[model samples]
Target: MKLGKSVNFTTILLLMFNMLLTSCGKNDDGSGPSPIPEPGDGVVYLPVVVHVVHNGEGLGEGPNLSEQQILRQIEILNEDYRRKLGTRGFNDHPDGGDAQIEFVLAKKTPDGEQTNGINRIDASQENVPDLGYNQNHYAQYAYWNPEAYINIWTTPLPESSMCLALGNATGPKTDLPGTEHLSIPGPNDADGIMINWIHFGESNIDCHARFGRTLTHEMGHFLGLLHTWGSGDCETNDYCDDTPPVDEHVYGNVPFVGCAGEEVMIGNYMNYSHDEVMNIFTNDQIQRMHYVLKHHPGRNALLTSPAL
Candidate 1:
């Protein structure tokens, strides 16, 4: 079945970029963390478990990410979520409030065997190409409890240049069997996260920069962050009012200059460029994430559970 007007992928890319560049200039300094809508008391803290599957290829040029590399990446996410990137100027908003989400590599396999939470599956499955999808057996063998654990599968990304991250949502079928596939390369509600190995290498100014943030970016999608440019119009906002309206998408590596005197936030994580300048989430982005956790079907329960 055709998916709408088959938004020309290129067009969608440009549109997202333009919107980001144009909105970069607006800076209402002191745009603090969004007020928590739900009471801070009963809110639950979610634990995250990552299932890192690799092709045995090194991090940049060759070999899979060493255990150290994997751990480092996870640390980055933890830091980003905690609003602490080490350096004060590392993030644009400066107010990178805590995401309230935490990830710890699982120590026990689903079968209760000792595990680093990093499952090293032989990257040799016909259906599971180099791009990913070999996680079925891992999740099956490990047996994800579904309600308790969120499995994040990491694998060498496909050489395909067009698609960076692919996310699947279970919608109302969160309880369906195979929901874990959305996180791995499986079919059901797996909620898989895919990242290109190239993003960890030297970045090209003409193309988006290479950074482990691809995983971070895709994770945002898994958490339900719409492109920062807002799908369309200011009304189509990323569900955040602080983010400015973007008309065009950023392409190649051009530093987005703010439009109409607004301070350009080329550093926003949702933009297309690979610049390190875009790191913080607007208060609205944070709210949207919280909104998903509180209102989305399986998310809240899963997040609040200890199995995560």
Candidate 2:
């Protein structure tokens, strides 16, 4: 089930080339795929279990990410959540914020066995499609208790070319106050993220989204945040006052003025901006996430899970 060294990279190149044709079109924004959240202890610590679904390539190569790669990716997640001052996640924007949440690699399995926090799946041997449109193909392998951990499955997907499914989450039915009626579609049933393997960790993948920000972006969705322009155009709001209502999802790091005539938060992770330019999560967004993490039954469970 192992892929040759060139196959994965070459495929990634093909995907990037496809982006050029699709760039003119707006991203089909809004996320579902419900990866819930956690709370309490002043600084919430949620355990994470990353499942690397590969074609059976060696560790750290292809999709079988090595321990070091996985570790670094988790670090990126933390840096963004904590808004660490010296890292890419840091920002001085008046609206910027730290979610005050941290992702702890699961030190134990659902069955209570010690683990290094990564699960490797050989797609070929496991009877799972390596590349496909249906995300449920890997659901059968999801952790027994998904809400207890941030279950992230990383692998390439055919839908990547559509500028749609590079990274997705199982998001909760957000109950953040003032927007109690506003729901996050329906990844409501399951929890966790399914991201394109190439963008899950640090890599020289020859693309604008190689810095692992896709996961951070999707994680925002997982914790119940919405796109800055939920339905694109001036049609809807993301429920975060700090984020202006933009016309559509922003792609590159270009300047943009929203429907309200305010400069858009292009650096905000919730938008579809490129990885190199994305950073802030904003004060309003942080509050929404904290509310969801504090009240959602499933999300609260993660905070108490023995896995942490």
Candidate 3:
């Protein structure tokens, strides 16, 4: 894992300092991750519900993405999680491993009614052009019980014309080992994923989201994984031994010399690499996500949910 380059002490300090604002919690109040369970043989399925908030756009136009686009996004998620061959997710890297998890649109609503799990909300009629600066506004519009379903909200995060917003997710309440968890505690009812309308699903939007990696990347955050270089330090640890620690993010370059002299894992899904280059999740990262499901806040509740 040694890198083929020497380190510059002063440059490293700046990188570490810059990462302070982006550091998330390992726990809401600071706690270590539980001992990882032995990798299991079965698959883990979690029910998902998407809340698409558009600016009065008709279905399949603008922010109102077509049903097929949404489904394709889910399929892409499966490809990455299962490490399906013949797809972008498959990789022969020694550290790579299948997450053994899957996401499915919720089959039943919390009230016991049949559902496709897609909730469409027209924001213009309500006079709210975007959720841009109004964080959690979507929660007021529509929210499902976090215990039963993982809610995904998509809206125009852009305020006036220019739009570069991506997506974000909530981490578990309990911190994982070496975790500097989300700054905001609580796996609140508003828990789950929030994505921009333009870049969601199909990635056909005119942005860097040429692929649906934003969801997969944020999903890693939602589970408990950290950036490849935790908090942007060479001495930092993402708790995944396979993902070497570096001082800064690597885009498409492989074998970048890291802060600790190990080869940085530029291709890990948790890194901010280009969508086309990011793919595998290390064996350790998989274990960390699995740990969150069984031990972090309401994550365990999803295991027993009857939504599916």
Q: lDDT tens digits, residues 96-142, model 3?
A: 98899889999998889998988888877765344343336677767
TM-score of each: 0.63, 0.79, 0.80
Worst 10 residues of 3 by lDDT: 32-41
TM-score of 2: 0.79
**Candidate 1 local lDDT, 33-128, one digit each (tens):** 433335123334554555544555544333254566667767766665555757322464544545655566666555667667666554543243
On TM-score, the stronger of 2 and 3 is 3
lDDT of 3 at 292: 84
Candidate 1 lDDT score relative to the true structure: 0.52
Q: For model 2, how does the per-residue alpha-carbon lDDT over 1-308 read when each residue is reduced to its tens digit?
A: 34566677778777778766665445455243323333433688888888888876787776777888888889999898898999988888888877789999888898899988888877767654533433365565555476678888886454344244577776776445334323343453445678887677777766788888988988887788888877554745777777877867677888687796788878989877887788898888888888888877777788877888
lDDT of each: 0.52, 0.75, 0.75
Query: How many residue pairs clash (N, CA or C atoms closer than 3 angstroms) in each of the candidate models, in the order given?
Result: 45, 13, 13
The most accurate candidate by TM-score is: 3
- Stretches off by above 4 angstroms in model 3 are 1-39, 127-135, 158-163, 187-189, 204-206, 252-255
